[model samples]
Structures are given as C-alpha cells and as structure tokens.
Target: MNRVDTAVHVEGLRKRYGDTIAVDGIGFDIDPGQVFCLLGPNGAGKTTTIECLEGYRRPDAGSIRVLGLDPLADHGELRRRIGVQLQEASLPARLKVWEILKLFSVLYEREKVPWSLLDHLGLEEKRDAYFDKLSGGQKQRLFVALALINEPEVVFLDEITTGLDPRARHAIWDLIRGIKEGGATVVLSTHFMEEAEALADRVAILRAGKIVANDTPEALMRSIQRDDEVRVHVEGSLDAAAIEAIEGVATASIDGDQLIARGVGRGWIARLVNGIEAQDASLLDLSTRRASLEDVYLALTGEDEYSPESPATEEAGT
Candidate 1:
C-alpha cells in the first residue's frame, strides 16, 4: 500500500438533522502522523465532524477522505486502518479487561501483545477487573488500550480526558503524546482549551457548525485582539491616550488608580515603560500577562468555559 502525505481531508462538509444543522461547510486537513485537535463547546459539531471522518456517519454534503479513501464507500478498509475512542465509551459490565483487548486485537490483521497493550496504557493491574469495577480513569485507560489493540494507522479520540480529575487528565495527556511519538496520525476532539493547546499540532475551532478559527494554538491566541496585558499601577493619573500613543500598545484603560495597558506586540512592554517614565509617573506596581487559548475560545464562542449548563453532546449523524 502507498503511504499518503495527508492523513485526512475534508472539503465543503455539511450535515444536518432536519432543521438543525450539525456541521456546515467545514473544511480542513490533517497531516500524516500529526496530532490534529478539534476544539469547540458542546454541540459545536466537533464530534459530528469527527464521526464523518471516522466513517461512522456519512456527510449530507461535501467530501471526506481518511487515509486517502472515502470514509463511507471504503469503510471496510478504512475501519481496519483507524481506531476510535468515542466520547461516552463503556464496555460490558461483566467483561474483564484482558478479554476485551484480546477480542479487539484479533479484529485487525496487525496485532499487539495483549499484555504489552495493558502495560502501555497502565492497565496491567486491572487485567482481572471487570469493566464496571474500574474507576473512571481506569475505564478510560482501558478504552485507549482497546482503541490501539488493532495497531491502527490513524486514531480518533473524542474527549479522551473529559470527567477525569487533574492527575488522571495529565496522565492521559502523556499517553496521547506517546501515541503521536509512535507514528499514528491522531484526530482529537475536545472542549478543553488546555488539552487542545497541549496536544494539537494544528487546531480548528468550530462554532455553530462551522470552523471559525484554524491555526496553531499559539497563533490562535495571538490572533485575538488585546491579548497582551500589562498592568501599571500609577501613583498619579495618566491619560489613557498617552499610554495608547506608545508603540505596540493597542489600548489603554483606567481601573481605579491602575493603568491597564493592552499591548499589540512583543515590544509593548518596553514602550509602555518608557512612556510612563517620561511622563514622570511613579509606578506603584507592574505586572504583565499574555493571553492563552482559553481567551480565544471565550472570545470566539461567547460561552463560559466552566458553564454548568452545557448539554450532553448528542451527535446527529451515525
């Protein structure tokens, strides 16, 4: 078989369930062996889009190719080459861990030693544990093992770390990094800003069934206006325009006695400092903070990251 440079490609993709559009004219590509992250709020069509590429659902419009093959038409070949971890995954309550891994390993011609998969995902200790007996983190680890049991060329991970505690989430992150290092192209879909920032070689931020932003995490954060913030606590009043006049300063504001200066470039800090000193303003305090992916997500979606009202994501297409 010939190896392709692009692991997955989507063009003008569209899907709808009746009047509610699930995905709308979205397009992006994933490079071979790259970790591509799909980031969005719940119901932002992240999973729906991923499912199309995974061959679980056919798009209502547009085209998708995974491993250079049509996901639906070539699903048999595609399924053998791709492994998936769905968002709300669970196994039979009575099934033991090793039994499931052993079962999945045979489904594909390529195989990984069941024990090695157990050790690789830190599930060696749970070999005898029933699926229902494992904790949330343990269950997730087992799922990852099952996903990789086939030694697939491409892996689709949907919300891999959702509901995991901080410690477990970090552990899962390490496992995902290891997956990339092993030469498999990974498509990750998640609402967690930090997960995307930490794992994605490239990210496409989906909003209302369409891609609103697509870039590296750093570039996405940088694209947001007013991202660089430097707070200068002035002993006396300083005109907002005077601070804004400094090169690299995008905007200036007053918060009580503090001058809140937002910078546009790397040199914003130096310019602000020079301008303040020249104005004979004594600095009571000074601190600088840069923007992050979370800021970009909030600005793009107009939704709180920690909002409790987020609906359980229900995908429309298969």
Candidate 2:
C-alpha cells in the first residue's frame, strides 16, 4: 500500500507463535481522520494485528508505517504521535486517577490538559478516586482519557467498551465521533456489529489470521445476497400460506396474530401490505428489517460464535 496520504499503512503483515499463526499476511491502509475498524471474533487475530502496528509485538514479516514512521524503527517518535488503549491494561491499585493521567501526560512531548480529558470522558468525579475504587465503566473511561492525553494524530482502541452498560457504550461512541471530528484517525477493534455500523467509516473483517472482507458497512451489506423481512401484527389472523403466495415474498409464517414474511427487498413491503389488505386483515403494527453488518460478517467469515451481547475477548497474544 502507498504510505503517502495515509495515517497507517501495512503490507504482507504476518505473525506467529511457534506453530500457531496469529496473523497471516494481511494488509490494509487507514486514511487520515477516518474511523477504520478491525472486526472479528475472539482468536481471529485482531489483537495481534493491532499490536504489530502499535510496536508492542514484532511481526515475522511485512512492513508498517504510522504517520510516515516505522513503528519499530522510529519507536520514540511514533509513540508520541499515536495513542493506544489495549484490550487489557492495568495501573497501580493505589494510584489515583488524576495521578495516573498526569504521569502519562508528561511521558509525551505534547499532552492535552489532564483534567480537561477527564471532563471530556466523564471521569472528573473519579479524578481523586483510586484506580482500584472506580467502577468498571469509570475505569474504562479513564483509560480512554489516557489514550487521548497525547493529542495523538492516530488513536488505536482495542475492545474499549468490552464490559460497559448501554449508556457507557454510547458515551464512548460519542467520544469516537468527537475524535474523528478533531481530525484524528481512529483504528477501533471490536466484535460488536452494531458498534462498527454506528462508528466505522470503513471496516475490515478478519478470520483465522486473514482478512475475509473489507468495505464500508453499507457497501458490505449490499454485497451480500440476503432476504429482507417484514413483521406485521394484525387484529385478524393472516394465513401463512396466503402471505407466502404473495408475488414478492419468499416465505411467510404466522404466530398468534403476527405475520412474519421474508422477501426480496424493500419494494416487497408495499406489496405485502396490499396483499394483507386484500386478505381483510387489519395491520396494527409493522416493521421491516434489512441486512446489517452482522449479516455481512457471518456471510463472509462463516462464523456464528460471536454475538452482539457476548463479552469481548482478545487473541492469545493479548
């Protein structure tokens, strides 16, 4: 990949542990100020790939460039220009949050105001609290603040919202959007399909040490051949056989007063409604479901072990 005009560039990247290959010759480039996501299931080599870019682990083969500098060769300069939040990290149990932030700030040539970062991540109240005393969500937010303390040109977040509640998850999503708006490139690694769909400008899906697919979420979803579904709750019973006989519907089933139909595309929605009306059924409520990132991931990787609600885990390398 061309290194010019890119925030991160990798080519023929490969890593291994004894006989087990963690990364197998993968390559992808991230543009400046774009939210690029590395998405895959646990043990899919997400952590290994990101760490190679962060200079934490050396790849057996391939080349990497972040901000126009080699991660391993120019470690000092690259460290100052890029921020990282690992999948797993730790701080001294006795260290107060403010102290942690202050300590990390001085390690870089340029740093953002520690307290301001705390406020931005909603960790100001925990600033005086010890690292061991903060809640899981609070601690995660503090780690995010630490990653941003350097005002990095590129930020790497690996499973940053792994165990947080819905509110906390959305807060971090907003922060990611803010990071992009501030002209910083973000490389986020996660298995959550909704999260990637919500935040990623482009997504690269990995599986078994290789990239299976890469594209915008919309484009990727469009690439797959899947049926759209429409569910309608009716006051009167709708015959499954009659609905299935509709010109555009592929299949239809009825449960209680609800009619569920899988069809070709959005255009079938209107046809189904008209068909239902002709059958003398009152449509009380209706909703349509379209192809999503999860669909694309499953179709490309053929992995169903990962779910949206499952806890996130990194590969063996950490």
Candidate 3:
C-alpha cells in the first residue's frame, strides 16, 4: 500500500495511574481514510490508548500525533478536527435530541450538519424526544450524530454499538462506512470480533497493555497454522485406507459415521469426493471451512471472552 498521510500516529505510548500501568509502550499508525480498529479484551489498554490519541488523557511517555498536531500540546486545535464518541457518553436527562446536537455544534467554529446528520443517523423523527426517553440504540445513534455534527477530520468511536441489537448494530456499521467514504479517518475500539473483521482495514490486537498482533483481518486469520478441517459424510462405513488415499489429506479421523479430514487447501474436498466415488461409496455431505478471528483470538490471548473477571484482577494483572 502507498504511504498516505498519517491521520494518527503513536510511538512507544505509555500511561500509569499510581502503581498500575495501564498502557505499556504501544505504537501504531492510521492512514488517512482508513478504518483502523484497536481490538482487545477489557483492561487491555485499548481505551487508554484511544484516550491518549483523543487528548482526553496525557501519556506518561511516548509520542502521539493526530492530523500532524501533538494531541496533548495542541488539544485546542486537535479537538476542532476530531470527533469522539466515548464508551460511556452521557447527556442531561431532560435535554432534547436537537438541543444536544445544537449545543455541541456551537462549540465548534464550523457550522454543525445537524439536519443531514440527524437524517443520516435515523434521528430525524426523534428530534423532539428527550435523552432519557430514548431507547439504548436510539441514544447511541444520537451520540454518534452529535459526534459528527462538526464534520471532523478524524472520528474516535469507542464501542459505539455496545448496547445495540443486531439490526441497529448493522445500521451503525453502515453509518461508519459512510463516514469513512466521506473522507474522514475512523479509529474505533471494539471487543466484537465480527465487528472488527467486517469493518477494519487493519487491526491491532492488544493484550496485557501491549500489542500482541497487528495486521489486516485476512492476514491475521491466515497466520494460524492449523490445517483446514473438512467434514465428509459418506453413505456407508469406509475403511481407513480408502480415506488416506485422498489427495491433500493430512490426517483422517472417524467420528461415529462421519469422516473428518484435515488438509491444507481447497482441492481437498474434490479429492475426497473422487476417492470415495472410486470405492463405490456415495457421498452424503461435505463441507469445508477455515478458522475465524475468534479462533485467532483464543489461540493468541487464551481468553474466550473480552470482559475481565474483576476490576481488582484487571488492575493487578496488567
């Protein structure tokens, strides 16, 4: 890929609170117009790293530049150019949707795109509703709309769809894509593996306050060395010798009546079918699949879920 102008850049970023170190020397870059995802389990410092980039918190050690300006030193200039949707955003309970958007718009020198932004976020009809009256998903949409009112050059979305249902989540994902297409860079921190895989151009996986893996989703999936597993259901019992004769068959195992074969690539399915047909055995069903990002996460971090067990453990473990 060509080296585009860097929208956000970090080098050896570190942060600590008293005795606990939250972020430990992490570094990455986001190119212009790219959807860069900071992925990790809870307490992995993904939020802290994002806070540093957003100028919400200062780093103890390291450098951060967003849109060619230092985030900490130039926070005034940086805030004008970036929009942030915090993980736990709150508005006055009685504030109307339009009131909140209009209030935020006044903070920026540029005029807020309230009308188009509200329409795009599906908030046009809810303009008169108070913040407390809206549902979780609707509130999330309103928060996103507020973030984009200023037409920022870079948008930081920290788990923007955490409480949304599947339909609402997909809608927000499409809105995010539209944001990227409109020439703004996006830096999102998410725990959902599918969300990262579906949207991120490149992902940085953080664990224990450090980066464990960083690459495109496809590249990260291919990095795992487990041979692809193909399941073949034969009509009748097949001898082990016949299964071994199939091309690209690394190993074959019989689970009850089904034949499970592990192989390297795509041709294994055809080869297995041909081998079975030659033996006068009918093939019942066959399926081939590769590993997903969830598998990759388990293999690397050894965690089944992203949430931490306890706050005390989270602070102590890191």
Candidate 4:
C-alpha cells in the first residue's frame, strides 16, 4: 500500500541510548481504522520503536510517517492528529477526572468534551472523582478518555489495559473496538497473547528490536505446523489397528484414557469416529481445539523472560 494511505509507517527505524541499541532496524505499517498490536517482552525495544513513531524520541536512523507527516520533523503537525497514552503517564493526584480531561482537550486543535468522552468510556459516574481516588481500572479508562479528547485520527496506546480485572479488561476491549469503529487507527504495544489475538486485525512480533513475524493471528498460528489435534475419550481401550484405519491420521497416542489423533484438517476427526464405531468402541467425549496465539508467540519468540504484571497486581501486593 502507498505510504500516504497508511496511518503510520516506519522504515529501518533505529534508536540508541549511549552504547546500547534500543531499537534496531525495524519497520511496519498501520492501516487506517485497524488495530495493529506490537508484541514483545521487556528490553525487546517495543517501547523505543513506539516512542519514535509517536515523536517522543528521535530515531538515530530510518524514517517514520504518521498521517503523512514526518514524526520527528513535523511533530507539531502530527501531534494535532494523533493521540497518545504513554506507559508511564500520570495525572496530578488532586486533579478531578473532569478537570484532567478538560485540560488535555485544550491541548488539541479540535476537542471532545469531558462528559462526552467519559460517557463513551463508561466513566461518566467517575467524572467528579479525584484522580488519586479512582481504582486502577478507573484510572486506565480515564487515561483512554484523555487520549481521545482531541478526536485524533491515530491513537497510540502502550499497555493500556495491563492492570485491569477481567471484567474491566473486556470493557476496555469493547472501548477499543469503538475507537476503531469511529474511524481512528490504533497502534498499541501489549504482551498479552490473547489480547492481541482478540483485538488486533494484524500483529507484529518484535524481538530484540526487530520484527520477527507479522501477520493475522490465524495465519500465524497455522504457519507453525500443518497438523491438527483431536481429543477423543472412549469407553474402553482403543485398538491400534482400528485407529490406523482413519484417513490422513498421521499418529495416535494414548494419554490416560483419552486418545489424541494428530493429522491435517477436520476430516480426520470424522474418520477416527467412524473407525472407532466400526470396532465397537463407544465414544464418551470429543472436542477439537485450534492453536492459539500463545502457541504462535512461543514458537516465534521463545517464551518471554519477563511476565508482564498488570497495574492491579503491582498495587495489591505492594
């Protein structure tokens, strides 16, 4: 696609701090109204790459464009059309939710009102609450509201829902969908495998400051291996000859009383069932599951060294 048509574009972007190279040569694109998630572990350079795109940090090399403006050279123009929620952002403790929203709105060329933004985020009831008085989830919602106050064309969210409860996390997911539906492109950094699989239209897996893989979640999972697994629980012991009779059945193994058949596609499941019936083996329970994004992440990046903790987790045990 043309660079001009993309909401955010980066090419061979590099960043360094002293002797360390934080962001190596990496590149990607964010399409308009699409949720593009960047996944990586701590010290992987996801943050550095995002900061360069947001114009908060100047890159040592390469190029970046946000809404057709150079992120570093034309930051003033870009800022007018882009909203950002930094990972370390914090508001004054005494500031009321409504006041904080109103303050940030004034920074944008075109702004949405505090109440309207809060209503969209399900934070209308907390509008008058002090920033420090709000819960972790409430603060996250308010941060999101402030980011969108400018009616920006592109929104940058860094670990936005990292510390929320399951209910709150799902709520934020719905809110993110609403943002995409409102014609705004979203670029976010998240370590949550399921979160990327659920919200992102496309994902880029970053490792050591470089993008190792980029594609749809489904495609990535499928690329790992061609084999599909079927779990079958039968009333009695399964015969090896009968199991081998199923078409496309590469292998069958017994784990406790459950028999697992591995092969290609859904056809193997039916063949295995029919073969079992032919042998007079009664079927007890059957289930089929696809490879998830977690499997894909582990295959591509190895297991992450740092397990990201949510804000609530940090707060509760501290």
Candidate 5:
C-alpha cells in the first residue's frame, strides 16, 4: 500500500531493551477511518509498538508515519493530529473531569466541545467528579473524552477496557465505533479476543514481539478451519444418531439434559433445529457457537485463554 494514502504506516519496526526484543521488525499500514487493533497476550509487545507509533518511545529501527508524518521527527505536528489513551494514564488527583477535559482541550489547535464529549461518553453526571473519586469505568471514559478533546485525525487506545465490567466494556466498544464513525483512524491494542473481534476492522495478532497473523476477524477465523458447535436443551430423550446423521455434523452426543452437536461446516444450527423438531423431543433452550477470534488467537499463538494471567506493566515490556 502507498504510505501517503495510509493513516498509519510502519515498516521494519524494531524495539529492544537489553537482550529482549520487544518488537521484532514488524510492518503494517492502517487505512484512514479504519479501526485497527493489535492483539496479543501480556508482554507480547503491544504496548511497545503503540508507544513507538505515538512518539513516546523512539524505535531502535524502522520508520513510522502517523497521518503521513514521522512520529519521531515531527513529534509536535503529529501530537496535534493524533490522540492517545495509554494503557495507564494519570492526572492530578484533585482535578475534576471537566477540568481535565478543559486542560487537554487548551493544548489542541482545534478543540472539541468538552461537555459534548462528556455527554457522548455518558460522563455527563461525572462532570464535576474528582479524578480520584471516579470508578474505574468512569475514569476510562474520561480518558477517552480527553483523547477526543483535540478532534484528532487518529486515536491510539491501549487496553482501554481492561478490568472493566461487561456493561462498561460494551459501552467502551460503542464509543470506539462512534470514534470511527466520526472519521478518526483508531489504533487500539488489546488482549481481549472479543474486543478485537467487535471493534477492529483489521487485527494484527502479535506473539513474541512479531505479527503472527493480520486480517479482518472474519478472514482470520476463516483462515483456520475450526468447527462450529450446537447445543440444545430438550424436554425429552434425544437420539444421538439422528443428530449425527445430519450433514456436516462430525459428532453428536447427549450430555445430561442437553444435546450437543459439533460440526465442520455452516448452517448447523438451523439443521440441528430442524432435525430436533422432527424428533419427539421438545427443544427448550438452543444456542450455537461458531469459531471466534479467540479460537484464531489460540491456534496462531499456541497459547490458551489463561496462559498470560498477569496484568501488563511497562516493566514487563508488554
């Protein structure tokens, strides 16, 4: 892709600390108005890569361009055009949310209305709350609002939803969608499989400081041939043979009060429902799970869901 047309461009990117290579000669281009995500486990170099792109850390090697400007050489110009919400952000403890937003807006040449942003982020009620008094999710929203105070062309969000409740996380996801809808290119780093799947237009999965896979969530899942599963709770007996007889079903079994079917192809849920309806059993609850970004992450990185249980820290080289 042409670098000039891209919102963010990186080529042969490398960063090292002592003997450890935090980012290993990686390269990718992000298009304008796209939601690009860096996904991996803790210490997989997601934070390091983001820091380099944000001009906070100078890369040991390679070139990076945000909004067609070098992040390091044109730090001042780039800062104005790009917004960042770091993995860990800080502000004066006594500062109120409105005060923080106003403070950041003064630094930008083109300022967005602070109250509008607070309203959009659902922080209108917390407008006067002190930074130290806000809950984790509220603080996250405030950080995001500050990131947008500049009306930036590109935004970088690193692990923005970590440790938040499900409702808050989903709300953050909606905010991300709104950011993209507003025409800002978003580069976010996350280890949460669902977050990447839900928000990323394209995902670059890093493992051991290098990109192992990069593609849209659907394409990545399609690249690997994983099976879909169907489960149904029935009021009466379920014939395992009847379910297994359905086309594409690899296996079927009755587990306690539920009928479970595993399949290699699509439309298994509809087929299973039809098959079950034909039987004497009454279907009570039914659900189907397809191959997800989590499956793709596990398959590509060779790491299980619980492998990297530790929280990411700067000292850990995340």
Candidate 6:
C-alpha cells in the first residue's frame, strides 16, 4: 500500500522497561479521517504503544510512521503536525484557561488563534477561570483545545474520557466525532467498550504485550462465533442437564425464567431446539443476539470485562 494513504502505520513495534515488556511486536495501520481505538486491560501496553506513535517514547525495536513520517527521527516536523492529549494531563493551577492556550499557541509555527478554541469548545464563559477552578469536564475540554491548537493532521488521545460523568463523556465523544468530520485522524486508547463500539472505525485489542485482535468491531465479534448466545423462554423450569449436554454449548445459565445458552455457532439453535423438545418443555420464545465487542474481548483475553476491570476504570472513578 502507498504509505501516504495511511495516517499511522506500525510494524513489529516493541517496548520494554528493564525486565518488563510493555509492547511486544505489535503492528497495525490507521486510515486518515478515521477514529482508531486501542483497547486493552491494565498493563496491556495500550499507553506504551500510543506514546511511541506520538514520539513521547522511543521503541526498543521495530518501526512506526505517523502521517508518513518517522515520529522519532522527525520529531520537530511531526510535533507540528500531530496533537496529543495524555491520560494524565495537568496545568499550572493558577493559570487561567486563555492564558495556557496562548502559551501553547506560541510554541508552534502555525496554530489556530488562541481565543478560537475557547469559542469552539464552548468555554468562553470560563476563559479566565483558573485551571484548578474548572470542573473535570471543563479541564478535559481545555486539554483537547490545547491538543488542537496546532490544527494537526493527526491526534493521539490516551484515555480521553476517563473520570467523566455520562453526560460529560457523551459530550467528549461528540467532540471527537466532530474532530474526525473536520478531517483529523484521531487515535485514542480507551478501555470503555461502548467508546470503542461507538467511535472507532477500527479497533486493535492488545493483551499481554502483544496485538491479539484488530478489526472493525462488528467483524471482530463475528470472527468469534462461539461467543454468540441464544435465549429461550419457557413457562416451566428448564431441563438444565439436557441443555448442558447439548453440542456447541459453551455455557448455560438460568436467569429468572429464561434459559440462556452460549454456543459455538448459530447452529446451536438447532441443538437447543432438539434438547428442549426431548425435555417436553414448551419453547415459548427463542431469540438470538450476535456476540458483542465485550464478548469478543472476554473470549480473546480470557480476562474480566474490558471496561470494569481496567485500572483506568478506577481512575474514571464515576
């Protein structure tokens, strides 16, 4: 593929801290004008890989290109073309909103006018508010504004919506959507399943320092057929033993009056019908739902749910 057609391209990227390997030979490509998400649990190296692409950390081995330029060897030129909102961002507590924006604007050769971000981010009322005085949501917006001051061709965000309430998180998602619409490639690392499902044009799921899964959310789910589930409703109790013995049944459970079974494929529906009939239970209703992204995550990593178990989830603290 023509490298210029891709926004970010990584191959055999590796990073380590002494004895600990953070990222291990990961590779992927991101298209321009798309929102790409890096997803994983704690210590999965999502942040490490993103930092390497942002030129914040050099890789121990392998290559990465952002906007068709080497992020490390071409630091100065790359910085001018890329934006970054780190997971843990802080500003001088005493500095007002506009003051910091002005500070960042002067650092770049070309940048959006300082006040324009205040208007664009709907922070005109807090233009003079001190950094410490702003609410969690407002501070996040300021960080985004700073990242955009340079009007970069690509942006990197680490845990963008961490610590935000539902309303605030939705607002940030909208802002990210708008950024993509405005023609900036956004690469974000997040643990939120909904965030990945909602925003990412494609997602890469990392685990144990390696790239385990990378694809569109729907494609990823469909790729893992065993995660699909079927729900059956019956007036009486289910024949738990017979259902459990059925072929393709990965797991079977009872929820209220429903007998839920997850199987290897849609063919499980046939196995389920046979099992139910042999038990003489009236199958009132049978329904099927495709595997979700969360299900795929659990299946690939064999870990807890993607969102709730991550340390980032605790950091969100909401």
- The numbered model that scores best in TM-score is 4
| TM-score attained by model 3 | 0.90
In angstroms, what RMSD does candidate 6 have relative to the true structure? 4.6
The local distance difference test score of model 4 is: 0.81
**lDDT for each residue of candidate 3 in 1-318, tens digit (9 for 90 to 100):** 123389988999999988878899998988999999987877788878888999989899999989989998899988878888834345788988888877877866555436778888898899899888998778878878877877889999887766567788899999899999998999988777888989999999888789989999999999998788888887867776778867788888887768888888768778887887877778888887788887787788886555432222122112
Clashing pairs in 2: none
List candidate 3 segments past 4 Å from native: 1-4, 87-89, 304-318
Give the per-residue lDDT digits (tens) of candidate 2, residues 1-318: 233598999999999999999999999999899999998887889888989999998999999999888999999878888888833345888999888888887776444545788888888788799888987678778877888888889999988877777788899999999999999999998878988999999999999899999899899999999899888999876778888888889999899988889999556889899989988888999998889999888888776666657753433224
lDDT by candidate, in order shown: 0.82, 0.85, 0.81, 0.81, 0.85, 0.84
**Clashing pairs in model 4, backbone N/Cα/C closer than 3 A:** 163-311
Ranking by TM-score: 4, 3, 2, 5, 1, 6
lDDT of 6 by residue, 1-318 (tens): 233799999999999999999998999999999899988877889888988998989999999999889998999889988998834345678998888888888877554556877888879999988888998888888888989988889988888787788788888898899899999999988878889999999999989789889999989978875566789897767767779889888888888779998877547779788888787777889998777888888888885535563442366311
Clashing pairs in 6: 163-316
Per-residue lDDT over 134-196 for candidate 5, one digit per residue giving the tens place of the 0 to 100 score: 987888888888888878899999888877777988999999999999998999988888889
lDDT of 5 at 46: 93
- Better model by TM-score: candidate 5 vs candidate 6: 5
Per-model C-alpha RMSD: 3.6, 2.9, 3.9, 3.0, 3.3, 4.6
Query: lDDT of model 2 at residue 102?
Result: 80
- Candidate 3 residue 166 Cα shift, in angstroms, is 2.3
- List the lowest-lDDT window of 10 residues for candidate 1: 309-318
Native-to-model Cα distance after best TM-score fit, residue 262 in candidate 3, in Å = 1.2
What TM-score, computed on C-alpha atoms, does each candidate reach? 0.84, 0.90, 0.90, 0.92, 0.87, 0.80
